[model samples]
Target: MALSPPLRQHPSGALARRSLLVGTAAWCMGAIAGCTSGAKPPSPVGSSSFTGSRTTAVAASSSPGPELPTAVRWRPGPGEIQPAAKLAAVQLVEALGTWPNGQSGVRAAAGRAAALGIPSALAAQLAGQAGSLLPPADAAVIRVIDAQYGGILSDTASVLVVCDQPTLTGRTVRPGGTTVDVRLSRTSSGWGVTALHPAAPGPARPLDEAAREVFAQSRIELPPASAADIRSGAVHDSVLHAMLQLAGSYRLSVSVVRSGHPLDVFGTDRPSDHPLGRAFDVWRIDGHPVVDPATSRTLITEFMRAAAGAGSYNVGGPVQLTGGATANQFFSDDTHHDHVHIGFTA
Candidate 1:
């Protein structure tokens, strides 16, 4: 099998982090094009303390971007692709999905994208997709949970943007969100979004005990698509049980579950544990993002070990760890560098 391909050049530590912290959609859409600052990237966690299989080719970069206005939020981890590319992927979602009171429709959404530098025609095409997805009245807010690579090579990239959305209409507020696979093409101007594919969650089904517990735990943040996966009873109880156990110690910012992820592992035909509901990915732990070089190794190591204790058959994160019951219980791979993956066999 082909291992993760080597990057032609590892970006200088200085350029590794270029994107900046942002709060509003207006700022994010404008910043993604070229507005960023140079900073030393957080140093990588070494492989000495962890173990596992299939090191993914993706590297973790801690470039910050737009965040929610509320205490409840999610952030983009360092991405597998270029920082600008990932930011653009996230910014496009924000521009299209968010709006203020009295503004909700294709015209409003398209206008936001056009202002963000997306081509006017393409912006309209993208906005045409909103349909009933956008609430007709009051304000709609979308919070990006994480932006990881769906695929990347040469000039094309697909970023899986997992997020949660809430629409406040008068006194009634609705909780909702979706996973959008944003496709971008390299352009002279910068990364340009070419398409957006949103996840279609199945109708909600009865939740099992573990699922119910995870839902009740606000600290265990779940994007709308993943919440639906658990609600549909599609996620395995073992996965839910482990999540609840993990939630006991650390606040988990889960990125993907059964929905909005490829059915198989990124570079292989081997069926992924996720689609089977046997695994989950955490982009952030206790407010420290795994992709951030500044994140403490001890924190991640303890969490991975805790996952193993919670009965995960496989635990993958940014660095390799020691003292696993099995030889490969802990691992670090490129794709997994930005998040901690807890996978169970049962």
Candidate 2:
């Protein structure tokens, strides 16, 4: 397919590639630290500002390559959508939510303050907000459930992040979370967050309706955190829409949904999409286990294809398929042997 006019005009490859490299390197460092003897495993880093997992490959030559067949073709609006800027927005929001009582811990979580070009005064103001909201005796964990680009104009961008905030005292409990609007500006260093606020309340999006319906059916059971998030509209609309569509055809046995779960991809430092509510897992389709030999291979194959058709860009299960809108969009992993994972992109 032809590139969007804006994507065609702007230089984005270099910055995107750089962002991916940095994100991967950071994951590696965290992983190595976790395995060291006597070293406490580090907390999983929040989603990288650059999300390499979600990408669209552009054809290099005029002849064009095989098109990624999809129900909807992903398009970029005018002006380059800088991955660095999106990443910075995520990082800044995370930093604001993760402040602990101590100055050192607060500084670590908000380390990107300088990179985000936040003035010292504004940074102090943010710290004050955090201090008032959280108890010093308890640690607060902020998980980004999904982030969507609200708008992008030249060097300025607006992003909306749906997140869950759980306080860890004797036990972890999530009261609820809200959608936050983060505004960022491009800088020599990269994207820097300049302003933050709550998104204005509005009517339900497609995903919100779907989530409510699925949960109401009570046929698909959800993990507690996922249930709470669904009730609070913390799950991303895209993910909820995909699930609702899938559920219409097959009875789904859900495994994970959002918070109150592990935050990283198993054995890797890369943040899992579950926390962002952009992903979900189904262990059974129509009462058949995906990994069971009794289950028909054709059944699993069709479901995977249908998932992609339902707007999921990433699908994983016991079986891997080829020839989709993108190569390797359908994958298989040992961790996914027992279920099917459907992931959406912002």
Best by TM-score: 1
Best by lDDT: 1
What is the C-alpha lDDT profile of model 1 across 196-237, one tens digit per residue?
Answer: 667766788877777778889988978678888888888888
For model 2, the local distance difference test gives 0.49
Residue 255 CA displacement from its true place in model 1, Å = 2.2
Q: Taking the tens digit of each residue's C-alpha lDDT, what string does model 2 give over 276-322?
A: 76787665678665645567788989988998899877788767788
Mark the 10 consecutive residues where model 1 has the least summed lDDT: 9-18
Off by over 4 Å in 1: 1-81, 128-138, 150-156, 187-189, 267-270, 322-328
lDDT of each: 0.63, 0.49
